[model samples]
Every structure is written in C-alpha cells, then in structure tokens.
Target chain A: MSESAIITPPLSDDDIMKLKIGDRVLITGKILTGRDSAHKRLFDLIKEGKSLPVDVKGQIIYYVGPAPAKPGYVIGSAGPTTSYRMDPYAPLLMEHGLKGMIGKGVRSQPVRDAMKQFKAVYLAATGGAGALIAKNIKSARIVAYEDLGPEAIRELEVENFPVIVANDAYGGDLYQEGIKQYRR
Target chain B: MRRDISHEKIKDTVARLCIDANYFLGNDMIQAFKSYIENEESDTGRDILKQLLRNAEIAEKEQVPLCQDCGFAVVFLEIGTGVCFEGNIIEAINDGVRKGYTEGYLRKSILSDPVKGKNTNDNTPAIIHTTFVPGDKIKITVAPKGGGSENMSEVKMMKPADGIEGVKDFVVDRVLRSSSNPCPPTVVGVGIGGTFEYVAFLAKKALLRNIGERNTDPFYADIERELLQRINNLGIGPMGLGGRTTSLDVFIETHPRHIASFPVAVNINCHVARHKTAII
Candidate 1:
C-alpha cells in the first residue's frame, strides 16, 4: 500500500475523514507522548478544572513511555505501548478536543464511539519495533510529570513517523477488519 | 567438596546477563524470523517481519534495547546441592538486577506497589525461581518478559472429557484473542496436566525452550506442530495487520494431573524471546 503523509497538531476534520482503515501514514510535526500514569494525571487535572500541563486541544497523543536516552541520542527506543489501557480516559480527552491517538492494540467501544462523535482517529505504530521507531522522532523534552520517569508527558517533534490508520472517525477499525479478512 | 559462591559474583553475572539479553535478540529468534519471511504469504506480514529483523540489527549495532519496555528481569536459578553460597541469593539477584538495569541504560519498569504506583527506580527485586539439583554447579537463566505479551497468558481448568481437542481449542483461542497485542508472530507456550499453579509455571518454563526445540514426547510434540499450524492459519498475521505467519512456534510441557482436574495454561512470548543462560 502507498503511504500517506500527514502533519499533526492541527489535525482537521477533513484530514481525519479522508483516512481509511489500513491506510499507512507517515505523520510529521509535534505530538504529545503519554501512557497510563500520565493519562490518569491528565484525567485528574481535567476533572479538577485545573489547566493541563500542555495544551492538548487538537493534539495527537502517542501512547508511549520511552527508555532513558543514552548520551548521544535525542530519545531512546520509543514505540507505541498498548492502547486498551488508555480506553477509560480517551473519551474524556476527545471531548476536550484531542484529535488523534497513536498506539498499538484494539480500543474499547466507548473510545471508538468517541472517535466517531468527535471526529478523531487512532493510528498504530508497530509494537516491538521501538529502535526503528525512535529513528523517526527528531527531538523530545518532558513537558510534565517528570517524576513518572518514562511515563512523563513529553512534547516530541517527529519526522515522517510511520503509523497505520487503526480506527477512523467514521467507525472503521483495522484490527477487526484485518482479522476478519485473515482469520480462517 | 562444597564450593562457595559470593554474592558479588552472582550480582555481576546477573547484571551482565540482563544487559546482554535485553540488547541482543536471540539467534534462534532471528532464524525463526528469516524462515517466516520466506513462508509468509502476505506482503504486509513479510514486510513487518523484515522491519523486525532491521530493528534487531539496529538495536545490536547501536547497543540500544530491542524494545523500550526492557521488561521485568526474571531469573531462574538451579542451585546444586553440593554448592554453597556465601551471601543471600535473593539479595544477590536483586542487586544484580539493580546494577544491570541502571548500568545497561535499560528501562526501570517495576513498581514497588501495584496500587500505589511508584517506581522501584533500579528495577530491583527480580522474580527469582530457584530449584535444587544434584550437580556441583549453579546454572542461571535470565528471561526478560514484557508485560504486553505476558498480559495475554491464561490458565484454565478443563474437564477431562475436553481432552486433546479441548486443549487445542483453548490454546488457539488464547492466541487468537491475543491477536497483535502480544506482538505476533509469537512463541506460544502451553502447559498441560500438573496442578493449577504448577501448570502456570510449566507454561512459563515452556517459553524458555528454543523455538526449534520440541517436547520429548511424540504426542505432545505433534500437538505443538499442530497448534503452530492452526495459529498461523488464523491469518492474524504479523502485528495483527493480517497475514500467514501469526505464530513462529508452539511449545508444550505436560505433567501428571489430579484425577478430577485438567489444568491448562498458555504463555505467549513475543518474537524477541530474549533468554540467555550461564553456569557457575
């Protein structure tokens, strides 16, 4: 399949609508990195009516917690973590204008429903392909919760980061579709 | 004659093994991928396999980790009856893990408390499973298990009537449910018979076997081959993106069971399958 190039941080409704299940995409531009702990904290802040550490409105959040970078690298081996753990917090984030997510694994029905309602999309980066994925991230810096270690929130400037459209705004899910097509 | 082993030696050795296991993909795993690439029919599956090969190469050449998770450091120690240790074995293992995780630049993934949500900082308190043997030498095996795949493992108590076909269904069903979550093509480990707890242990121990190795019993060995073919036939493919090579290998370990219970367990390992052994 030919790869599509998409830029992030201002992902539009039209851009998301054009994405189909199974379309490979190389996303470039700024994205936020967070995983379980960060999501919990973000959810708490949202509930408290306090401002989040970073502006998540219309941002693409990648579910990852990278290894500590060695001396010469901008980031260590960084790849998508499982997405199901984030399902509980996702609908809340979508209501807050989060436009997209990047992770591996299937999402819950609520998350899929939120994507359809809020016009968000879910992309999947190859799991266990961390070293290769790290090469695509240009730079990274912690934006919040540094004490969470790898789970800290970081703003990453990525270049041509590879992902596949796993869930689209129109209720398409690649995990189910791919399995149904391939499963005997 | 009894030989005394120091904690420092165990500590240092554990540290080095952890680092090596995390940084280098096992040769057996690499070979499995090479063969899968040739056998996989789907373009996407083949491409994913190729990318994994490249990822391993990059990790080895650069001395980075094969995956960012690095995993919980699990140690299996076989202590000889004739051997004596000068210091605490558990302490030595934990110290070794702490040094390995910190010095190797691997991720510290353990939490001190499951509910409190605090990092242990150095990934200490390694899960050490020790068994006593008759030899004079202690053998240590380190298998760093990732949570993504570990989460998919299962233990079930089936009726005796379920029998072999039942075991097959359970094993294949577990794999299908795991899909791409455990990062197929996966190495499936099945443990049959044994008591409930022991079966789970057997399942995990089965994962330590090399992908090419088979059970000694022909019956179980044949079952392994059949399960492998069945799982691959699911077309879950690599990364669940869809394809022919969902599982690289299936391993089965069986033990005598109680009259009333048939306990089975499935342990899944990602393609990396990082394990290394040392004898002292």
Candidate 2:
C-alpha cells in the first residue's frame, strides 16, 4: 500500500532512522554475498584479531548461494538463503560496521538486538524466488573464498533489487507485526 | 510374465526428472499460488505470491532452477515384482543425479562426508526409497528438497495416552515456533505412527502428494483439514513476513504403530515444492 523507498548502502544513521519495518525498498549499487561457510571463516578471522580479506564497513552482505550461470548470463538463479545459520557471525559483523543484511527467515534475538544497537537493519527478498531475483543482478565477481564454491564471497552489482524492511534500526520487526495484525 | 529393465533406462529417466523437477514446478502448486493470492489479506503477501509464480515461469522459460538450493535428490522408486533390473539400481540412480546436476547447471549440494567432508562436486547418491509393487513397470519420482524447509522438520515420540490433542498440539506448535524459518506458505507433511525413523520417512513421503490433496483415510483427512486451518490462523503469510496464507496445505500419513510407540514427524516443504514423476 506504500511506495517503495529507494536506498543505497553505506547507510548513515539518518538514513537508518528513516526506514521502518514493512517498508518496501529498492536497493541499487554494489552489495556483498556470503552464507554459512564464508561467515564462519570471517567470524574466525575477527576472533583472531586478523585483517579480513575484504572490508566490512558500510557493506551489506546477502545470505545467498547461487546456482552456476550458463553461458551469456551475468549470474544464475540467486535468492536469499535462510538467515538463521549465520546468526553467530552477524553481531560481530555489525560491530565491524556491516550496515545491513539481506536474507530470508527469522534472525535470533541477539541479531535483532545488535540491529538496534548497531543501526543495522535486516531486509528480506521473496524466498524461493531464485530466477526472478537474479534478473536484478547486473554483474558478479568473487571477492574472496573462491574454494567455498557457491558459499564464496562475491561482490554483486545490482539495480532496483526488491526487498522488504523486516527489521529496522528503531527495533521494529515486520514478521512479528504482520503476525500480530492477522493472528486470529 | 517378467519384464526386463536396464539400468540405462533408469539412469536416463532419473537424469531427466532431476532437471525437469528443478526447472519446472508442478502445475498444482501454481494453482495453489493463484488461489492463495486471491485470499491472502496482506499486500506484501499477495505480492510475494505473485513474484513466486513469476519466478516459476521464468525458471521454466529460462531453463534455470526454481531455487538456488536445488536440494537433496530424494528418489522414490516402486518396481513391480515381475520386473528385473539388468544392472545395479543404486549406481544407475547416482549416475543420473551426477549427470542431471552437471548438465542442468543445478547446485551440487551433496558432500562426501557430513561434518568434515569435501563437496562431492556432482550431486549423487540420491536418498532413494524403493518398494516392490504389483505391476511389471517401474515408477520413479524425484523430489528435490531444500535445506531451509527440511531443517524445520521434527520427529517426536509421544505416549499413547497423549492422544489426538497431543498430536494436534505438536503439529501446530512446530509450525508456530518455525515462524518463517521454513519459508512461509509451506506444505506441512505429517507422518504419524510407525517407528521413529519410519515416521520421518512417512512425513516426507506425505509431501509427494499434490497440494490440497487429502489423505485417503477419513480420519487423517479430517486431521489434515483441521491442521491446515489452525496453521493459517497463525498469520505467517508468504516468506514469513506475516499473512493469512501460512500453509498452502497440510497432509497426514498414518501407519500402524506398536502399542507403546506413537511416533510423529513433520517435514516442511517450501512453496517451490519441486518433484517430477516418470514411469518405465
């Protein structure tokens, strides 16, 4: 019922403050991609007080593992994977200035708490919608963890990528609010 | 009268089924989405359903996977007692999985080991369930199950005294607790009775039924209807952003259990629900 808000990442406090749960968003520009294995490796590096292969500040990582592209395609079917598996690494990533996450399913309470504390928000694309979602990705190149295969950290150039604000910095949660609205 | 079936027939059929199942969703599921879209109250929920339908269309037209997970290859094989296979059945099926995943560009999700194993690179060694039947033909069904929804499955052994209320409570509780984790607008496959492991298999087998199809047993059909309604009341809409269409359908499969054991399992399947069937 509301118009989708356009957002470009490296989101500032002011930008975070303006978003709300349930608001539709169109994200453009570059974003990062990773899932369970990649997150685990990054989490350990942070724990060891070592520098990361890529900087985390002002970046949004999509929890996705894409199918391989055929010839003449920028990427193959790519959609958000469940976010819960990466719960252990999220709060720490937030602490390191990861401003946003794009994934599906519910996050742990700690991740939500970190969202409020760190001014990060969790967004969701339609789950199981791999092919349609991939159309928005203009280009993709692996940035790190190539051996991880699909779980590798790939940087993506996306335009008008559709998502919904599932969790906002002000502690608004869309999943709970939607359930509350319709629960009979 | 016996009919001979070579391993090549099965291998080629499975390889083709694997690609088709991942690339094209069943029409019944597309109908479910069309109907649910009309009834889903949330604007977001309806939009998500629309996108899903579009995703399926694109997958078919583009010859791509419906989901990136592509899933664990679960094959259901029913061979007639009069049919004899010429080669190793397991090897043929594995060869099919490897061929399909590679040729179709689907994700190879299997690992040689569970915890510390390297990727198999080619998805093979499908989770196969074989049964002997009355006819001379062989029937094959390939259901590629995604991990997101599969992780939400559970197996619980309840006391016989726990009764119907306990079973209902467990099914509802699992979905409620699951929230959007399994991907919303899921299919709830309930397997009741049998041993713990058999119950789990029943639950997954229950998923092979078409969406909105009820169990043949009147008693289970009623339970499926009730559970479906109760789950929709939870308001977990599409993608778990909250909506009235939490479950596209609920299916219950029952087997006779021992006097003391009442094992029940729930296998959740996402909206994409990919499966295809072929007979040889």
Candidate 3:
C-alpha cells in the first residue's frame, strides 16, 4: 500500500484502467462543489455564454449539498449526494475544462464518455462521511446561486482530501469492476 | 378523558427529534456496520464499511449530521384518543421543522414540487402519518428518509399465489438493481398483505423496528431471516463495493389482505439509518 501507487499522476484512459479498486487517493488541489440545482444553473450559464462564478479549467467538482453550518463551523456534514442527479449536466462541465469529479455511486455512460474525452477523473468520498470531509475544508465562500441555499456553488480550500477513484480518465470505473468481481 | 398538550411542546419535541436523529446514527445501525466490516470478503468493501463506521462515530461526537442528505422528515404519530392538543398538530410539526433546519444546521432537502424542483425552505410540510391508539400519551417517531434510498422503495400488488417467495424475489431484485445507488449496506423494510397504500405504509413503519429484530409471528420472522440471508448472498456488500453483508437487516410487517390480492412493498434505508421517538 505504497502512497505512490495510490497517488498516480492523473493519467490517460489506458493508464487509468491499469489501477484497480481499493486504491486510496489523497487528492490535493482545487475542487468545486455543486448539486442538482447548482448544476442546472451552471449549465444554463454556460449555455448563455455567461461567465461562471469560478473558472472550472483543470479543476475537480464535488457533487454535494451540505447541511447548514453550526455556529463555529464553516460547513455542516458535507458529504457526496447521489451522482446520478448531476449526470445531465456533467459532460457539459467536462467540455469546459473540468478535469475531475468527487461524489458517490455510479456515473452514466455519457459521464464516463466525457471523462475519457476530457482526460478527467471521477473520485468518491464516502457518502455519509460529512463531518470528516468538512474537516478538509479550510475556508468557504459562496460563488453564485445564493437562492439555492445549501445547493449554491461555493469556493472551498481543501487539503489532503480523501477519495477513491470511481472513474478514471481512461474510462475505467471501479463501480462496475468491483460489482463484477464480487457478484455471486 | 383527553389530557391537553400545548403546541409549544409539540414544536420543541419535533425539532429536537429531527436534530437528534440526523446527527446520530443509532446503535443498531452501528452494530450492523461492524458486522458488515467483519464479514465483507472484498478488501475494498471492508474498507468502505470501516469508513462508514468511522463516519458515524465522527458525526456523533461532533454533533454534525451523518450524511449531507439530511432527508425529508417522515413523522409517525400514535396519539392516544385520550389526549387532545390546543393547536394544529401539523402546523406545529412544520414550525419545529423550520427551527430544526435553521438552528440545528440540518439540510433543507424537501422540495415543493418533485418535478418542478422548487425547494420548500426549512424542510416544511412533513409527510406525517397519525393513528389513534388507546393510550393516554402521544408517541412521536421521526425518521428522516433520504432521497437515494427513498427512490428505491417500491410497492407491488401480486397475485395471492406469489406469497412469500414472490415477495423475497421482488425485494432481492430491487436491492440488486440498486447496487451502490442507495448507499448500501441498507436495511430493507417489507410490508406484506395489506392493500396497496397500506402495504407501503406498513413497509415504512417496519423500518422503525430495531435492526435484527424479528417479527412477532414465527412465519414472518422466518421469512425475514431468509430474505436477510438471501440479500447478503447477492454480494452487493457495503456501498456495493463487495462484501458478505449487503444488508444490515431486513424487517417485515404483515396484515390480512383480500383473498384475491397480495400486496408487498419494500423500503430501503441507507447505512446511516436515523430514527428517534418521543412521548408527550
């Protein structure tokens, strides 16, 4: 369980497939947060040729709608929601320079195809590990869609974020592989 | 002889229950997670279950929610015919929900329209089910039903010949199809026999039972055990990552049905199964 093995440099499709399930990743970098409502707004903004509140180029986005923060906290139990809900808007975001996604569950074929085409990756934080995930966020600020409340797009600074590689840029999906291996 | 209960008490109780249930995964759920971890054959699945267990501990200690999807509130009330309330019970429940969402920092996941996608701020207008019982006290149970698991719930009116085997098949099929989507390992609640709507209601009510608890009836208890074993045999495992424990538990509640009809409903609850009850 070498750290280097798990932390492969973002790779091409063929290279990503070489990695298997159970690999742990300590992701360090910029990742945007969005859920269903925010995703719709983002795609709408892109469709209108309007500027996105945050530039998505080479950035990862986490699909989450967090609980409201307690008095002293920056965010509440902030974990991944179901990724399927964002399936409709994901490819478009990938086309606009989004390189990675962090959420739970399986992705649709279109989203997988987008990952292959854009050299992006899909990572998954545990679905219910909200408080632990929130600990990774050092700061947070609302970027857009204030009316959406918890679903709004927020800029967050993170450190050593934990995720499992669900889908890699090379079109390898851990979900499918894992299920196949374990299916009785 | 109805005893009067104030609206304020109702509001406070609802708010507290909502926050408590969301922030803390019950002991039974935690035990199920541990069992999943110990029995899971896949390394990845075991790791995922371990993470889930740790997540629960973190949420409990920190007083933060166990999941981002705090869920739409489903409140079940068994009110005594002998108890009377001064104000509207439903409105008080909504007000408590508002305060709970705002002050407790739970997510307001409820939407005004499922199709139009209009969010009802403060997670208002709970799906409340009330029944009158013969006690002098009112018992309230709140279960925050998450969308992922809720979407997997289904009700089917099968021919009387379908019986227990048919029920088992349908439940397993649904669980297998769901895979990682509903955030396994999950608790499957089965409601059998009753009418279509009553079956669905029974399925939800069955979820309130503690994990691994058997139905009082020997016949249904055996069915529950068999279903639990079969579900685990599917190898869906934790988070569908692969394990020996795909389901934490399977609970069944049954009622008499028309001779021609056999209705069954299945409701799935994710690993972060949250429910709490209070009496007033």
Candidate 4:
C-alpha cells in the first residue's frame, strides 16, 4: 500500500475519516504514550471525574512502554504493546475527544463501536519492531505517572513514525479483512 | 562425584545471555523470517517479514532491545549430578537478571505483584526451571518471553476419545483466536499427554526448540508438521496483517499420561522468538 502522512496532536475528524484500513501512514508530530498501567490510572481518574494529567482532547495515544534509555539517547526501543489490553479504556478516552490510537492486535467490539461513533481511528505499528520504531522518536519525556517506570506516560516527538490504519471510523477493520482475504 | 561450578560464572553468563538474547534474534528465528519472506504471496506479508529482518539488524547494530518488552527473563537450567554449585544458584540467576536488565538497557517490565501493579525496577525474580542430568556440564538457556504471546497460551484437558484430530483442532483454534494479539507468524508449541500443569510446562519448553528442529518421534513429528500447515493456513500472516505465513513452525512435545486424562497445552512464541544458551 502507498503512504499518506498525518501530523498528530490536532488530528481532525476529517483526517481520521479519510484514512481507510490498510492505508500506510507516516505520523509526524508529538504523541503521548500509554500502556496498561497508564490506561488504568487514567480510567480511574475519569471514573472519579478528576482531570487527567494530560488532556485527551483531539490527541493521539500510542500504546507503548519504552525501554529505559542509555546514556545520551532520547529513548530506547519504543514500540507498541498489545492493544487488546487497552480496549476497555479506549472508548472512554475516545469519548473525551481522543482522535487516534496506535498499537498492535485486534480490539473488542465496544472499542470498534466507540471508534465508529466517536470518529476515531486505530492505527497499528508493527509488533516487535521496537528498534526500528524508536529511530523515529526524536525525543521522549515522561508527562505523568512517573512511578510506572516503563509504563510511565511519555510524550514523544516523532518524525515519520510509520503505521497502518487497522480500524477506521467508517467500519473498516484491517485484521479481519486481511485474514479473510488470505485464510484458506 | 562432584565438580564445582562457580556462582560468578553462572551470574556473568546469565547476564550476558539476557543481553544477547534481547539484542540478537536467534539464527533460527532469522532463518524462519527469511524463508517466510521468500514464499509469502501477499506483498504486505513479504514486506512485514522484510521489516522484521531489518528490525533485528537495527537492534543488533544499535545495541538496543529488539522489542521494548524485554520480557520476563526465563531461565532453564540442566544441572548434571556430577557437578555442584558454589553458591545459591537461584539467587545468582536473579542477580544476573537484575544486572542484565539494568545494564543492558532492556525494559523493566516485571511487576512486583500481579494484582498490585508495582514495577520491579530491575526486572528481577527470574523464572528458573532446573533439571538434573547425569553428565558434568551445566547448560543454561535464557528465553526472554514477552507477555503478549505468553498470555495467548492455553491448557486444556481433553477426553481420551478426542484423539489427535481433536488436538489439532484445539491448537489451530487457539492460534485463530489469538489473531494479532500474540503478534502473529507465531511459533506454536503444543504439549500433549502429560498431566495438566506438567503439560503446560512441556508446551513452554517446546518453544525452546530451534525452529528447524522437529519432534523426533515420527507420530508426534508428523502431527507437528500438520499443525504448522493448519496454523499458517489460518491466514493470520505476519503480525496478523494477513498472509500465507501465520506460523513459522509447530513444535510438539509429549509425555506418558494417565489412561483417563489427555492434557494439551499451546504456548505461542511471537516472531521475535528470542532465546540464547551457553554450556559450562
């Protein structure tokens, strides 16, 4: 598939709606990172009606828990963790104006439904490609949940971070479609 | 009857193995990717495989972990009865893990408690399995197992009548349900015949086999081949984006079981399939 480029932080509904499943994309700009622990913390704050450390409004979150950086490096291998772990928390964030998510793996029905209704898109970064993906991250700093270690909420400035649309607002799912096409 | 092995040797070797395993994707894994790339019909599948190869190269070149999930350091030890250790073997191994994860710059992914969710900053408490053998040598293998694929593993006690056909179905079903969750193009490890817990252990140990190796028993070997084809036929492809290569290999290990019980366990290893070994 050919590539399309999108700059995040202010990803619009139109930008998300235009992305079809299977279209490769290069995402450039600042993105926030969260994984299972961070998601759970955010969910708890939302349940209590407390303001999140970082606003979810019109933002893209990548499900990643990065390795501790070595000396003189901005970040270590920063790659996507499994997305299914975040399914329960994703919809609520989407409701709060989260426009996009990047992770690997299949998501649940509720998550997909939320994406469709909320006009959010799910992007997939290749699993186990952390070293390759980390090269795209120019800088990374923890924004919140510092105690979470690898699971800390980090803000990363990425340049041409590669991804593919796995699920889009218009109801296309790359995982199901791709398997259906190839499975015998 | 006993030859002494130093704790320092074990610690240093374990540390090195941890770093090496995370940095270098094993030759067996690299070869599997190469073979998949050559044969994958879908352009996307081929491209994904190529990217994995490149990812591995970049990891090695930069001394970075292949995946941010450096995983729980799983150590398998075969200690010969003819040899004795100079210190606490388990403690030495854990210390090695602590040093390796911290000094190697690998991610510290282990939590202090499964439910409490506190980070074990140094990635300690290596899951060590030990067995005693007859020779004088000590063999240690470090397999850094990621959570994604590990979570996808399953163990089921089947009725004796379920037979080989039933076993095949269960293994394939597990992989199918897993889809991209375990990071597809997975190495499927099937353990059959042992008691429930033992069978699960067998399934995990089966994953330690080199990808190109097969079960030596003809019956189980044939089953391994058949399961491999069936899993790849699922079309989960590389990273489950869809393609001809859902599973690179299927390894089956079996043991004698009670007549009434038929236990089967499936442990899937993602494409990274990281492990390294040293004999001392």
- Scored by DockQ, the top model is 4
**Considering DockQ, which of the candidate structures 2 and 4 is the better prediction for this target?**
4
| Model 3 share of native interface contacts | 0.69
DockQ of 4: 0.90
lDDT of each: 0.90, 0.92, 0.83, 0.91
Q: Arrange candidates, best lDDT first.
A: 2, 4, 1, 3
| Candidate ordering by TM-score (highest first) | 2, 4, 1, 3
Q: Name the runs in model 1 displaced over 4 angstroms.
A: none
* Cα lDDT tens digits for candidate 3, B56-141: 88888888888888888999999999998998999999888888877788888877887886788789889999999997899999
RMSD of each: 1.3, 1.1, 2.4, 1.2
What DockQ does each listed candidate score? 0.77, 0.89, 0.67, 0.90
Ten-residue stretch with the least lDDT total in model 4 chain B: B111-120
Give the interface RMSD of candidate 4. Answer: 0.7
lDDT of 3 by residue, A1-184 (tens): 3442433233334544444445677765456788888899889999999998878876778888878888888888888888988999999998997777888888899999998887777887777778778888777788888888888888777777788777776677787777677767
Return the clash pairs for model 1, or none: none
- Runs in model 3 lying further than 4 Å from the true structure: A1-22, B115-117
User: How many clashing pairs per prediction, in order?
Assistant: 0, 1, 1, 0
- Model 1, position A5: C-alpha lDDT score: 65
Lowest lDDT 10-residue stretch of candidate 1 chain B: B39-48
Greater lDDT among 2 and 3 belongs to: 2
